[model samples]
Target chain A: MSIELEIQLVAVVVSVACSLAGVFLVLRRMALMSDAISHTVLLGIVLVFFITRDIASPFLVLGAAAMGVATVGLVEALVRTRLVREDASIGLVFPALFSIAVILITRYAGSVHLDTDAVLLGEIAFAPFRRLEVGGVDLGPRSLWVMGGVLLLNITFIALLYKELKLSTFDPGLAAALGFAPGLLHYAFMTLVSITAVGAFDAVGSILVVALMITPPATAYLLSDSLPRVLILSAVIAALAALVGFWTAWLVDASIAGCMASAAGVLFLLAFLLAPERGVIAVARRRSRQRWEFARLMLAIHLLHHEGAPDAANESRETHLGEHLRWEPKFARRVVSEAADEDLLVRLQDGRLELTETGRDSARKAMLV
Target chain B: MNPLRDLLFDYTLRTVALGAGTLGIVAGALGTYAVLRRQSLLGDAISHAALPGIVLAFILTGMKSTLVLVLGAALAGWLGTLVVMMIVRHSRLPEDSALGIVLSVFFGAGLVLLTYVQKLPDASQAGLDSFLFGQAATMLERDVVVIAVLGAIALLAVVVFWKEFKILSFDPEFGASLGMPMRSIDILLTTFLVIAIVIGLQTVGVVLMSAMVIAPAAAARQWTNSLSVMVLLSALFGAMAGVTGALISSTAQHVPTGPTIVLCATVLVLISMAFAPERGLIWAAVQRRQQRRQIRADAVLGDLYALAGHHESEHAHDVTVLEAMRAGRTDVHRALDILEERGLARRDGTGGWTITRAGRAEAEQAGESGPDGQHEREGSA
Candidate 1:
């Protein structure tokens, strides 16, 4: 396969993997944690570089995973202490760790190729430059391999622990009573999030990792209720977004990550407007249509009631049933014409619209129905 | 005297200190409500969302005044919040999810604008990039004055609405039942948070400003339970973190101000979490150990009383020390020694342990209570 196709295919796979994990993260209200972990992973990378003096060492991933766990641990500790809320704890820990990473990068500028900009916004275009070779066969990108492994790990972890995760997420108190440790499950989820975030960061950047992790799953949430469906839909959305975003970037000469995020935003907007039952436009349309039908039925009933009045012979043209309806003249005329055709109303010799006997009976039946 | 004078005279140091101090005070004060309302991340989101507004203001106005730029930023921040609220209300998406969406979209737009601004012919745009990660050294005296005035106003508003805010935050349903306008109160709170975020955006940038708001409030919570006290302490903590961050960054050249301030705030949070009274880790551990000791002493005393009664026919008035010791378990021995030392119990002529008047009173009190005595009483009564 050509390198371009291979890169695109790998991007799709990686996006799907991250987004699948993202579904659970977003549902659990851990989207910001993903952002935090992705950014703070730089500290781990930098620290590992400081010790090993090798930026490309595999130990960097390990160091990052450790830091990710530490991030979760610190945040959880702060929150449990009740000194700070969860958001505050997250707000406190990640930036400090990230700043320390930035300081380290600047302090050891000569030894490390990593910089704040690189850490904050990765260059996905450069992924194709680094190749993985197995038995003299050139693999597209080393990030692809790393991300592929992470993806496999995530699927297995999720699959094996699906019931546990579901139980814990939906009802933690019950899970605890049933001999499952909610705290352990929480940490396990965070660990998975941290690893996926780190892997996605290497492939995309911190910002894109956040966007991909949060937006697709969030969008899917708007569209579905079931957890498995949300996960599947989120993955599909992310993969599709990646492909479209990459193409848009190529066509418009914009940043690929930005385009990808924008695409996700578009998808969310679409879902927001079109999703069944809960979509804004759908709800609005349903309400409007229902109101119109109610009005029409009310107009029919009013005409029928007027026709049954005993003083109907003395009524003037201004006192006509159509005039009493007070709808738009054109709409009122249309309603009268339709009713006349249906034998529900009749146009009298005096230019007054009156309901027929059949119309009165049908209108009463409609009201009861 | 010369060193102090020189330190004070340094323009970079003085300006950074002033800027950070003002920013910190404002962020901390506003953050109290943010943390209470569970919208701490809103500050972070708004700060990031402000970037595009700043860039757009610069692009459109072709001016570099901090005032114009900050106003534009406040507008964008409020707009971002509005969008988030709309999404949350209209869709099934949760609040955090909506916030995440707004954060990324606005930040992305800001980045696009920033890149565009960079490519402009104006050299004035050169310093605009610093807003992403703030540089306190770049602040002017005017910036400090603006921040101080805004900070004062924000604090004053918080004070005026202190009761309403407290009621609304802890229990909005109660507030509403009391005929308080919850929506308006909520708007007032959000407006304050937005203004705080906008003002701090210039000094601490997007990401780090969020830390400034949340960290100090978090730290202050560890030390106090009262709302007013928490707000005051949080502001104090914030100012200290800001000043220290500025001072350290200045002393060691090239350190970015935003990250430094964030680092200081994080340190304060850590310190408070580990050491503060009432809720801190150390306090909790100490309380637990103290409770254990008390429970052990109570157990021993109760056992002694039980033993004394068991040997004697009908509620015996006194018992020998050896009889009490022989009847008690092994664990009670050490507790009995401590009780004797404290004069609660005494050793009699026959080596039987006997409860003193004080020990008898204490034993009676302890026997009336258990770990769940209050709960049982509430349930039964």
Candidate 2:
């Protein structure tokens, strides 16, 4: 395969894996923890490398996974003490560990190939050069296989624990009561997150890993309400982002990981503005719609309140709506037209609004609710 | 010569250490508000978000001056924070997600700009990358002066608005209800934080900058319960970390200055967590042990009083009955030892134990205040 193809494959697979885990993180309100894990995982890699003197040792993966879980564990411990909040705990734990790793690398391992820059902005272009050989056969980029394996592991973990994850994420107390051991599940999920984050680092840097993990799932959440739909949509969004981001990087001749994150960011912005249910536009539309309906109900209830009074005629007049409810003439006209369209109000021969039976019932119900 | 005297004499080392110290004090002060408000992660986001601004400033002006770069970073960090606040307030998405989005997107943009800058003809772009991991040794006297000036202004703002900031941090709603311009205070506080973070970016860099903002405040939090004391201690701890880290990293070859300073702050946190009075883990454990001993002794005395009441006589009873009441005899034995020390119970020297007149009176007192004991147990647990 061509180097470009290899890089694209790595980007897509890694993005999808991250998005899969990200969906649960977003749902559980632990999105920032992913950022923390991505960073502190560097410490695990550095620690393992320090001992083994081999960057490719499988032990690095184990160490990275342990470190990821440790990050969550330490954060939880801090929060349990009630001295710090969740975000504060996250901010406290990761930097300490990451700084230690950085110190170790720059001080003790200065002669080694590892450095902080590579860790921060991983080069996918160079990822194509590091090929895995099997029995003297050229097998393309090594990152592809590693990322592909992690992606597979992520899928299997999610697939097997989907029900448990959904249950525990939404109602952990109930899940615990039902013997699912939500705490254990939380640790297992965090472990997967750590492993995936470390694997993706070679293709996309740590920041982009956080981006793909959070942005795609968060975008999908804006678009979909169902868990399964959100999961599938997030994966699809991640894959598309990977492709577009790769091409943009290619065109600009810049960092592929940065471009991917930019692309994901652009996609999230689109979803934020245009998604069907929870998007900004949708929410604004809903609020406006509710406002109009509320005005109409107020009109109906006002007319009903003055039905038999001496000033009922004046109160029910179309001209009085502007003064009675203190609405603009244009706004009142729009509300009247909308009410007429909904058949909630009738205009009498006297040019005054009288609520139809349906309108009266709706106003009563709106007030009751 | 003393190390302090030696430090003051080394011109380069003195500049770097003083710069770090100033940066630390400013961050620690603002970070007290951030931590109290539970917005510690906002510092992390703003620091990461400053990268694009730094790169853009360099690209636009083609200058590598610390003041210009710091200004650019401050603007970008504030812009990113504004967007996060907008997203959180305007959308259904939570603050954490908004923070994450801004952090990554701004950082990603920064990376692209950085790479683009690197390819430009300007060879001076080398210093820009140092803003990522930070090279404190490269800090110039001009940069230190800028940091000190800004640090002093930020610290002054914190002092001037101490009461308002305290109210805003603890309960903004109450402040707002009292007709205070809470929203303005919040923005002002955030501005202080952004400025503090931007100036420190040169010394601590984007990655470890938030650590400087949060670590000292968190460590000092363990040491004190009062807000004013906490803030003062946090600044002290931050300055100590900064100076100590600069000294140690300078003495040791190959150790980066920023992370070393952060590690010193973390060590302070570890010490505070382990040894701080009242709130420390060890202290809490010791308190728990003492309470457990007291409860066990109370239970043993209560049992001996019951034995005296059951017999309708003031006679000694077999100590085996008390031992049999508990599954573990160690608790019973230890409780007996405490009871004897308090003159509440005594062994008859034939494997028998009897309640003293003082013991009966003590048990009666405990019975009268038994409800409070239950409440105390619950509170302790």
Candidate 3:
């Protein structure tokens, strides 16, 4: 296969992997923590590079994953102390570690090719150049293999402990009483997040990694209420975004990572506007329609309550009902016309409107619902 | 130090220090309200969302004056927050997701605008990149004055409405019931937050400026329980972080000021989290240990009293220290030693021991205590 196809394929796999974990992270309100871990991983990378001068050493990923765990640990420690709120803890930990990394890189500038810009935003276009070989057989891109391994580990871990994870996330106190060890589960979850973040760093960089990890799951959340459905939907949405974003970047000649992030943003906006039941526009439209129908029902009920029982004489008064309802004449007429079309009302000879037997019962049922 | 000291005396360092200090104080004060309202992330979001506004301001006005840029930034930041609130109120999505959505969308638009601006044929746009990470090294006297004046205004507004802000933050529903305009007060608070953020953006940039608003308040919270004390200490801590960050960056030839300041703020937060009294990690650990020791001691004393009252006919008068220790079991030996040390037990002639006045009182108290023991006296009958 050509190098470009290999790179694109790796991108798709890694995006799905991250999005799968992103579903839980976003649901658990740990999206910013994911962002913090991705950025703070630079400290681990720089520290590892300082010790072992090889940038391609697999130890770099391990070191970065360790740093990511440390980032979560530090944030948790700070927040539990009550010295810092959660957002404040996040703000404190990542920047400090990132700056330390920058300072280390600047101080050791001569021996290292590491730069802050590159660390912050990686070169995904050049990812395919770094190949992995096993037993003298070329194994395509190394990032793809690393991410694929991590993804496999994540799937196995999450699947095996799905019930435990679900219970712990939804109710930690109850899980703890049931001997589930919430602290163990929390650390386990954070470790998985760190590993996934480190794996995706080469393909998407920090900002896009955060954006993809958060936006897809967040959007999926709007589309579904079930955890399994959210996970599946998030992965599907992320894979689609990765494909569309890559093509958009190719066509527009823009930064691929930036374009990918922008695409994720667009997906979120689309979900916000179009998702059924919970989408902004859908909810607004539903509310207005409910209000309109309620108004029509109220008018019908008022006429029925006031008019002399749906007898022959009251049916004559129903046709001249526009002046009594006190609504705009046109609007009242439109309401009556629509109600009659639904057989909830009948228009009399003198232009008044009378409620049918069906209309009275329907109005009562609507009030109860 | 020769050339560096000379440069430090120049107008640039002075202006930068002034700007950083003003921004720190203003952001620190308003941040208390932000943190209390659970909108700590709002400052971070607004700072990022202001990027497009800055670029748009420059695009429209074709000027790089500090006032115009700040005004434009404030407008964008407020608009971003307003959009976030609107999305939350109009949809079923949670507040954090709505914030994340607005933050990413605004920042993405800013990036596009920035790229376009960079391509324009304007040489004055050369330093726009510096604004993203901040370039305090290039700050002027006028910029410092602007920050100082705005900082004073924000401070005065907070002072005049301190009671209202306190009521609104603690219980907005009650405040509304008491005839307070909760919405207007919230708007006033948000306006101050935006101004504070806008000014700090020039000194600390978008990413780190949010840190300035949050870290100091967070640190100060560990040291004080009162809201007024928290706010005051937060402002002081913020100023210290700013000054120290400036001093460190200035002392080091290659260090960037914004990250250095942020690093200083992070250090303060760490120190408070680990060492502050009452709320710090170390303090909580010590408290837990002390409570365990007290429980052990109380258990030993209670056992001694139970043994003493076990029989009235056999050795009804007193018991030997050895017998008391042995009867209480192996776990009570260390606790007996502690009780003796605290003068809660006394040894009589012929190796007999008896409960001292304090020991009897402690035994009675332990008997009256409940399961959780810490609040036994007040909560128990």
Candidate 4:
């Protein structure tokens, strides 16, 4: 494969890995924790650099992942103490750790090649240049291998504990009562999140890690209700975003990670406005339809109430219904026409509304519900 | 060698301090509402989203002015806030997810724009980098003036609409019932937050700017329940942290101004969380410890009374027996001392302890009430 293909593949794999765990994070209402962990992992990388002095050491990955887990632990501990608000704990913990990392980098390692921007805005365009060679054997890009491993680990983790995870996430009290150990599962799940965040952070920058983790899964959530479908759909959306982002970056000569995030944002906006069942437009349409249906029923019930009255014709006339029911003349005409078309009520030559059999049945049914 | 005189006379130190201080006061004062309204994460999204605006402004204007960049940042931040609100209103996604999505995606777009700008032959690279990581070393007098003007406008708006903003922050539904235009008030309040965030973005960089807004307000919250005091204290804490951090960064080699200021604000948050009188962790822990001690003491005294009743003639109980009955963590000896001090237990001639009449009465009363140390359900913010 060409270097371009390799770069895009790396983006796709890394985003896919992030979305796998993001499903749970969004479900748990801890989406901000991804932001926190992605940031604090920098502290782990910087601290480990003090010992090894080598930015490329594998230990940095381990240390950073450790810090990600530790961030969750610290946030949970603060929340457990009940002193800090849950959101405050997250907002407080990560910036302190991240600022320390930035400070350490500027103060202690200014001359080194460990650029904070590189960490915050990862250079995925250069991933293809970093080859994974073993002895004299030629291998592909190192990032592809790294991201693939993280993806595989996530798949295995989720597959092995699928039932338990689902049980705990939807109903933790029951899971704990049934001895599934939801609290332990929570930590275990967070460990996966930390590792995935660290891996994605290395590929796409810290903020894009949040974008990839949240936006894809969040978009999928609007389109589906089942867990398995959301997972599958999120990965597919992530892959599509990677392709579009890659093309945008290529055209604009920009950061690929940033472009990918922008792509995800655009896609989410589209989904937010246009999804079939849950999109804003669809929801609005359904609401307006329900309102019209309610209006038609109100007309049917009104006509039925005054069927034999002396003033029935005056009260039930399509034009006079507005004054009696407190609706606009134009709106009452539309409702009257809609009911006539549905055969729930009819407009006579005299301009009065009369409920048909189905109309009377519909009004009585609506009242029962 | 006089620090105060040097702060007044030294141009670099003075500019850095004044610029950061102005940002702190503005962000701190406005962040109180954000935190109170549970929109702290929204502030984070807005700050991150401002990055694209900064870069876009630089791109269009071909020059870097604090005013232009701040305006762009404010516009972008405001747009991001609207996106979050719309997502929450329209979708099943929680508010945090919306916050994360907008912040990361907008920041990503900013980076893309930044990269594009950097590729240009005559791009102002230094100005862009300063906005990214912040360059307190490069702060100017004009920056301080811009921050102060914007901050003053925000503060004036707050004062002008104090009751409306307060009601919007604490109870928008109630405000709506009273015929207040709540949606407009919400937008106006968020506009204040956007201005505050953009004001800080230059000094703390986009990434750490939200801390300036949230930390001071959160810390001030621990000090007071009153809205006026919280806002005042938040602004004061922001300015203090900003100046202290600026000074520290100035004196120290290679210390970036923005992160140090964030660190200073975070320190205030820590101190507030651990030591604030009514809501502090230390006080809560102390109360818990004392309550546990009282319960243990009561249980031990009750154990002694039961033992004394088991035998006739006001029989005395051995320390070993009390220890056995108390089991682990009873600290029977301390309980005995407490009972003795209270004139409830007396040491017998045989080196055993007997429950005195008053002691028997106390133990009976405790036993009748039962050892139900009711754990109250703690409500969180």
Candidate achieving the largest TM-score: 2
Interface RMSD of 1: 1.7
Candidate 2: clashing pairs of residues: none
> lDDT by residue for model 4 over B1-381, one digit each (tens)?
555676899998898899889889988999999888877777889989999999998889987988999999999999999988888887889999999999999999999998888888994555786777678877788888988999999999999999999999888899999999999999999999999989888888899888888899989998899999999999999999999998888888888888999999999988998899878889778877766766666677778778777788488888898889877668888878877887988888997988889978777765665544222211110
Better of 1 and 4 by DockQ: 4
Q: What is the i-RMS of every prediction?
A: 1.7, 1.2, 2.4, 1.1
Q: Assess chain B of each prediction and give its TM-score.
A: 0.88, 0.92, 0.88, 0.85
Q: DockQ numbers for every candidate?
A: 0.57, 0.66, 0.37, 0.73
| DockQ-better candidate, 3 vs 4 | 4
DockQ-wise, the better of 1 and 3 is 1
lDDT for A208 in candidate 4 is 91
lDDT of 2: 0.88
* Candidate 1, residue A50: how far the Cα is off, in Å: 2.2
Highest DockQ scorer: 4
TM for every model, in the order presented, reads: 0.85, 0.91, 0.85, 0.90
Check candidate 1 and list the clashing pairs: B320-B352, B321-B351, B321-B352, B321-B353, B322-B351, B322-B352
Give the Cα-based TM-score of candidate 3 against the true structure.
0.85
List model 3 lDDT by residue over A172-196, tens digit each.
8899999999898888888898888
Ranking by DockQ: 4, 2, 1, 3
Candidate 4, position B333, lDDT:
81
What is the descending TM-score order? 2, 4, 1, 3
